[model samples]
Target chain A: MAPKLGIVAGSGGLPAKLAEKCRETGRPYFVLAIEGEADPATVAGAPHAWVRLGAAGTGIKLLKEQGVVELIMAGALKRPSLASLRPDWRAAKLYAKVGLRALGDDGLLSAVIKELESEGFTLVGVDSVLTDAVATEGCYGRHRPDAQAEVDIAHGFRVVDALGVLDIGQSAVVQQGVVLGVEAIEGTDALMRRCGTLRREGPGGVLVKAKKPQQERRADLPTIGPQTVDLAHQAGLRGIAIEAGGSLVIDRDEVAARADRLGLFVIGCRKPS
Target chain B: MAPKLGIVAGSGGLPAKLAEKCRETGRPYFVLAIEGEADPATVAGAPHAWVRLGAAGTGIKLLKEQGVVELIMAGALKRPSLASLRPDWRAAKLYAKVGLRALGDDGLLSAVIKELESEGFTLVGVDSVLTDAVATEGCYGRHRPDAQAEVDIAHGFRVVDALGVLDIGQSAVVQQGVVLGVEAIEGTDALMRRCGTLRREGPGGVLVKAKKPQQERRADLPTIGPQTVDLAHQAGLRGIAIEAGGSLVIDRDEVAARADRLGLFVIGCRKPS
Candidate 1:
């Protein structure tokens, strides 16, 4: 029997791609796709079932039924509206055990992993299989940062990197040498829109996105794509600096094409010492 | 000779009031006020000379000229547009040694204090003189928190406190348990306004302001007053939660009056565990 794996699919095509890669490697895998978030096309390409994000126990039971002993998480259930769906007994018990720290995505996922592991499923990192797709250092789009924006980028990168190291946030909206906004749970797109209304002047804005030092790299990896570039353009943000190798650039070719057309500077920055 | 204290005045009446209190105690003092930010009333009330916020060398020289010995920071400063401020030789040199971290208010002030102490002048905290004025726990305005808002406030308080603990920021904008913004150098008003747009579709937001656990109490106590409440109302925020006795409620009566009229929740939270 080929080695079996399970994929916890969130939003986007990444999970579908991962499944295809698994097929190429001749590994039989099962996918637990999040309802309303996972792409239908992606689900159709793999052996999968639709489930609510909060119903972790059901997901694990299905995986167990399929003889899956290992799991990989891909994408994210975008701004998961957790207001409606009720958790099952396994999820409720897991919630009671995890308490306050379990409020955020990181905590919620870690708790789910622990529960699955206790049930004899060994969770594998998505990166262990998708290493080649991770981002790389240097200019990624047609536009290179001008000297002034480069200086702002360097300064902004340092500030956002420190913010990330503290695990307070991942992205900061900076113009010139001053920070206008730090992305908390609201995320980057919301931050850019905030900037558009704040300072009517200044040379648009520079956005810095970096990975936290303590962040789990495989799950919830910081990502950028054409949508991000488009959002930045709409919100008047001129540039973005993302950590190389530690961040994911979804649809690299399309994202670069969009960045190029928009004349936006999208550079992959290495972590500063 | 009467005991002399130093006042590092920023942008309001608090510095002058603190100076008057010093005089009442028969303590002679020197006031180093920020030129563009300090109220003219503050300048008139204290024995002072004004200098730009970033002009560290000039500020140090003036304080020394006034025979200043101990320092206490009071009031607030208009956060300088760092992109425009031309740092003098002294400030630039300090930046070379300290880098971007030195740009934050606490970092810069601490650096200044270190330099002053090296020259034999001691630094005193504002709390040493204004302890009686610190706001204690409980309600201040017409609105008491609904159970849901209280839950959100508790969640907001924890997140804001964590932000402070990391020295990432001292204020956060929250709504329904989601953090909408975290303060960087942008300050509270900017953070509130940013959140207003982000949460426009939902209920209004909450502003949680607190001092960092490691922050110097005397030099930079968090403050809120009528204008702060007014700004929150203007930005569509529903409530304000500040740490009790860790902050100052400037013009307390006026703040209460405004909060009452606006139907806003303004309360000092019990010092967090």
Candidate 2:
């Protein structure tokens, strides 16, 4: 029999979807739902352990007890400060050893992944489980990016690349040959809402997301879904462009159908270099 | 005597200050007050004519009639869409000739400058008109950036430098090793307001403004003033940094006093090579 798989759940439906997949495949899986982050409903019928984000060694102990030899971290967690984190003793010890001067989000995540790996649990990537979650190149649905949108999408990619080098956020919105906004700590939702007010009078903006150059590839990739399409539509955007092979699309069919219904284009473009 | 000075006044106190300076220096000057932009009080008691932003040939005619030879564009003008701009025949002609693909703010400004230059007018930078307006190195008031703030400030500069090559906006805020936000077409005030909601738990972010690499030097410069300080304070920012010699600091004394009262720092630093 395969080793028991552990899902470290945070916010959003990705974790729930992963759990449902395991149930359908008849694989034994356990969830470690993070308090104040993961939805309780996601863990309602699954064998799970509840813990705060700051539970370091204790969290590992719970997984070990459940015979979880393989782990998959899914969903989103906001970057919290050390004070807000309220890390336990083991967590505090790990942070001390990170020795990061410019403490980036990716750096903290890398440290966490290292600690998990040292405990003898193999980190299974999302692609290894949910095969279709990975984005691929080409137009997604009924609509397509016009010539104007292509220009804006190109600009957005350039902005993301420059920002990625500095460990900044991964998304940017460009419209009618002008940058509307770039995502930072505020995340993609806020970026869209803010850009809504800043939209120009021509064709609408395109939202582009890429993997931050400094991101831990095994831990996370940029993600988009039905909510992303909804946000883009509400923000008066004409389309969405995510980096193919470097981003995850939750429920591709649902995302495409939503984009079609809302009169928007959703495409996965190859990152320029 | 200096050439007959023509002040193309937009929004804010900078235009009024410039007009007052001309009065104090006894330089013959005419103010081209932009309707719906320049405060009426600013052009009061000054030789002036009102014009819409789209007034091109007629505006130049008015300036020439006033015997004005040197033009100083002052204050802020929000970027306008061509549809809303209602461009006159001459203005439309210039826009058509520019042929910009990814039409950045700087590219449009450069085109405008060339049009005026070809019309036999000399465009002077803000530094030349208001000698004290240009930013200088060092802290302006009571606060110096702490070690953390300094790191953020450095990060902010890097963000601006990266954004500059693409002709994006010149200001960004960083705190606790994270980029809070970047200025785009929405301008600095909106950037501050949005970032206020995104501020982290530790020390406040620092606002950094630099000249976009492709900006038109003889026409405009990145600017800050007492109002900039107020915005930063309201946004929970701790300090302000501007590129020395490349950014304008309106009413420097008043700005320092306001920053000090608000418990914020305002400094100017050299742009990193």
Candidate 3:
């Protein structure tokens, strides 16, 4: 018998894409959507149940009922306010065990993974199901980065590495050896918009997205899609670069097509030696 | 006879305040205002001349004619667009000597200082004329930062230090061991407004401003004033902490009074050992 997969869906198009992949592969799966985070329309017509963000116990119970022993988390969940949380007994216990108050998003996710594993649910990475989406090293579009952009890419990598260590962010906008902006709580889209406003008349910067050096790679890998290419072009940036084999290049062909049309370079850079 | 002083005025109330101090002391001085940067009203009734940002030759010639030997630069000047600049022979020579294209604001300022000194102008620090505006080490408001705010302050200092090394901006907002924002070219006021939008229900972060580790201190020292306190309070921050001796606390009494009334702490922190 084939293994039954479970997707703990959050916001954005990733969850929908994952569900479509499951359908195409003739695989059995279930979707557990978090209220206010996962779009109901995206998971419609699928085996799904809605649970609050803090209802870890409730989510597990629903998954078990549907015979879900293997799971993957998908999409982004903006960190919710403390007052909005309604943690159940299981979540409360886990929080106490992990000392959740002191941990950042990565720490909290790590603790949650450990807790779920202890409950006998095996966690699988999203890439296992969406293998084709993974980015490969080298340029994907018609345009290639010039020498200046290459230098910027190297500088951006170092910056993102340092930021990862502090668990601050995974993206940086750099132009001509100067860092234009570093993303914190604001998402990539907002960061790109701000960079657009700050662009000078000359050649623009590159948007480099990489996994945090210490990031738990099973989930939360850096991702870019066609929209990302559009945003970069709109921001007057010359190119978009992501970590090779460490980021998802969603809609790869479309992303390449868009980049070519926009005269932007989309390259997957190798991690610095 | 006291050496006649020259004020290289930029935009902001600081130039006006410096003029007031010169008047109070009955000192002989001249203000060489940048055409688009400094307001004419600020230096009214004083010996002043308007010159474009690129007119370094004209400025130096005027200062020499007025018998000005000592000079201090005041206020902020947003970097001008290339199209707006009309670099004369002197400015062009200075730029070529300094390789100004590769430098950030501080590096350019340092090169300018060296060039001015080489031309026989003694560059004095703004603090020499506005000693009262320099922040002293200690708390100045009724409210002291709670233990958490103190920790945030220490963390903020480290963040700012790292940022300073990169020639990034000199301010950071941190809360609960997480950095909420880091200021880049957008500057302090804009940074504070963004932080206000990111604040949650819990205790807010503290704003820490410090000089870059390698900053040329004769000009461009970090500064805060009554308006800074207001912005911090509006951002829901617990307090404002600045580098003592390295930062200017303009309108000291007014800042303290505002902080006290707003239940915020205004502290001048000693540099970490």
Which candidate leads in TM-score?
2
Per-residue lDDT of model 3, residues A178-255, tens digit only: 577777667678788888887655667899999888877776788899999999999999999999988898899999
Q: DockQ scores for all the models shown?
A: 0.19, 0.64, 0.37
Residues A1-273 of candidate 2: C-alpha lDDT, one tens digit per residue: 667899999888888888998999898999999988899999999999899888887898999999999999887766665666788898989988995346777788888888899999998877778888999999889899999899989989989988887777889999878888887778888899988888867678899999987677766678899999999999999999999998899989999999999999999998766
- Listed per candidate, the RMSD to the true structure in angstroms reads 6.6, 2.1, 2.6
> Which candidate, 1 or 3, would have the higher lDDT against the true structure?
3
Per residue, candidate 3 scores C-alpha lDDT tens digits across B211-271 of: 9989888877888889998999899899999999898988888998999999999999999
Q: Hey, what RMSD does candidate 3 come out at?
A: 2.6
Model 3: iRMSD?
3.0
In candidate 1, what are the lDDT values of residues B1-273, reduced to their tens digit?
645787888765678768878878888888887877678887685678878867888988887888888788787654454444578888787767766532455665566667667777777767677666687798886788776567667777777666665455678776655566788756777777666665633456688888877776756677887888988888778889898978888767788888999999898998656
Residue-wise C-alpha lDDT for candidate 1, range A1-273, written one tens digit per residue:
546888888776679778988888888998888887788888785789999876877887898899997788887754342344476777778767876321555555666677777999787777677766677898877788776577767766666665555445678776655566678766777777776665424466688888776676657777777788888888787878888978877778887889999989889988866
User: For model 2, what is the error of residue A54's alpha carbon versus the real structure, in angstroms, after optimal superposition?
Assistant: 3.0
The C-alpha stretches of model 2 lying farther than 4 A from their native spots are none
- My TM-score estimates for the predictions, one after another, are 0.66, 0.94, 0.91
